[model samples]
Target: MTIRVPVVERILSANDQLAVANRAQLDAAGVFSVNLMASPGAGKTSLITGTIQALQGELRIGAADGDLASSLDADRVAALGVPAVQINTGGTCHLDAAMFQGALSCLPLGQLDLLIVENVGNLVCPAAFQLGTHRSVLIASVPEGDDKPYKYPPMYRGVDALVLNKIDVLDAFDFDVDYFQRGVQALNPDLAFFPLSCKSGAGIEAWLEWLRAEVRAYKERRDVPGNSGTDH
Candidate 1:
């Protein structure tokens, strides 16, 4: 008397449909969206906060903080005076395309050059959904161990960039940087990797420059054909 579920392909097909529409919406607004995924205590919030501060006066940034129950991160980002939105997923584990479209409705899309969605802290679940982001950045901290990419292959496989955070504490832990890079390369050979320390603000300049170039490129590609002289 057990009910049988359908195949995994069916579930993925449904998710993919929603992602298509989400991409259209973001594209129409000419905004470069990024989905940030990581485990708990991996410094997702700190990295995001640091990004906002570092990119200030240089880029128009918007953020959406996703959490199971709390809006603390959203509050902190809002206090930074940027346009930040909070999406409480209740008992849900991760955010999908529909959730992002709903939360983004309250944000001023046209005013944003970059939109960063902080997905709920779960390595396995969050990577399965696509929220119309142009890219996905996966954060794996030192305390989480360097073997994360091998153990959570799906998470590493889906992202465009990898942030190896907590480099300042690498000496305190038994993690090997070379080994970690090798493991990640096995899955995503060309994936951009950044070793950063949010606490000490080390190794942040390169990442910030990369971010700036991405936003600029997106803007250039989206500009009107006849209005090439416009700069904002």
Candidate 2:
């Protein structure tokens, strides 16, 4: 006799339902949400810390720092005086939408102008989940090599912006800027790419400016009357 394996459609349907609710909550709160995803040691924390500092006075910022074990990243962000909550995934490699909803509940979402979610430090798995964020930024350091876009296509494909960190180490390593750009373009022709050395504060202005514009636009669209109702 043949045994039948039930389809898991209901499982995914439940996740999607929760994601919709999460998105609605953020939208009603007028929060501009961004998901930051990257490999371990790719400077995800540093970029987030820097961004929060830069936007501290300009915008009301909040963060949800995700890690497999520690709240180290969350602690760092909280030190900046921003509302930050830590989500320890236990043994899981990535964060799902439900986890994000829990994180949002802990934050001052209504007072927040922008919410940055520092996703778990793994390129592949983090990219697979949406987490109901408006934009996704993928960080790839020079030390990670130029072939990352080809090797990890899903991560690159899902990103709205790409941050190439650690450009200051280009002289120490055989990192090809042009080759990396071409590879990323091949995978995502319209991807907005920025190269920055976060440690030295090189090329960070462009990213900050882009973020300011994005948040301003989001606020304008959501706060205006007669505008299409948004769930961003």
Candidate 3:
């Protein structure tokens, strides 16, 4: 009998190879990239807009907005005078490395200090694919309930940082912050957490500061001889 390998395994393996190539390209350009994932209405675009506004004049930021269809999110980012490219997934739930490669070509990578890819609004599928970013951030809104971390452990466990958006509505919703943190901690003990409301701009400064720090750190590491191509 002939041995057979699962198609899903082969697909993921190809994706990982492409992701490595993407990482190498980003590294060559000295750009620090982030893959931002969240569910629908989780404020992924809002956070991107807020970050662009906050970091304006400080960093040359670019974005790739991935969605099932429409250029709305990309338009929003461009409206802020930031360079953004839209990736229509054609009903795909998540953006893979191949998609990112095409989008990256449209961005002025040489001039950008940081690049943020706003992934398709699906917590489950987006987390399963790698986009070759320096970090992966997941947005969990307060209105989505605090039990999300428990229900979506795969997404929670895979992220480097978590953005707890819509905190301003905590009073209206019965979200338990402690409970949410507990569940996330169980999955990722040292994951950085940022609780902020994109609508109200509350706690945005702290998040911006973190982004600035991470970008600087990435550049610093890249400056080290023999470390330019390594992804942390």
Candidate 4:
């Protein structure tokens, strides 16, 4: 265990270094990036689709879909007339800065105003690595239960925002919104929460507005002199 500790630390250190470089590249291109994470079947793809549809003409959107296998998510984004790249991790549980770097190479960064990296569906590992995104978002579905925040405190604490997807099915599920909010508040008091249904499109406008604000903020910060584009 003691020997493994230093190995893990070294790995994280290297990953952080690469993440810094990735952020620099993103800043140079003046693109706002988001690292989106969630458990399997949490409507991540659907949410990305909805977001792209909402901001299509206003913002040139791009995506990098990270998955253990399959390019289905990338295909979905591309079908919406967005540029998307697929990062097949080949059983890796998460996407690190290195993987994102490769994906960015395949994307037309200069043409994109917003970039969303849909991370591999995992509540834990994806939160542990920084992908040099301006914001980190987590998607939690109603069927996943409200106790997820309590159970996955690390994931909850690491993200800047939370998307409570599939809210249209709340009446069909036993999710307790208050309980989830309380748990999240204990971990991150200022975390932004968006409860919306990707299927029904209910409450999506709020999330889109928030995303627009974030993109605007990112651009404003990038325009400021001496801003190294580091995660704020």
lDDT of each: 0.86, 0.87, 0.92, 0.92
lDDT of 1: 0.86
How do all the candidates rank in terms of TM-score, highest first? 4, 3, 2, 1
Pairs in steric clash, model 2: none
Please report, as a residue range, the 10-residue window in candidate 2 with the lowest summed lDDT.
1-10
Clash totals, every prediction:
0, 0, 0, 0
> Where is model 1 more than 4 Å wrong at Cα?
1-7, 224-232
* Tens-place lDDT digits, model 3, residues 65-179: 9999999999999999989999999989999999999999999999999999999999799887888898999999999999999999999999888999999999899999999
Better candidate number, 1 or 3, judged by TM-score: 3
Candidate with best TM-score: 4
Q: How accurate locally is residue 123 in candidate 2, as Cα lDDT from 0 to 100?
A: 79
- Which has the better TM-score: candidate 2, or candidate 4? 4
Q: Could you give the C-alpha RMSD of every candidate to the true structure, in order shown? A: 3.6, 2.5, 1.9, 1.0
Off by over 4 Å in 2: 1-10, 226-232
RMSD of 4: 1.0
lDDT of 2 by residue, 1-232 (tens): 1332233455556777887888788888888889999999999999999998877989999899999988899999999998999999999898889999999889888899899999999978887666888889999999989888878999998888999999999988899889888888888999888899889999999999989988888877876896533534
188: Cα error in model 1, Å: 0.5
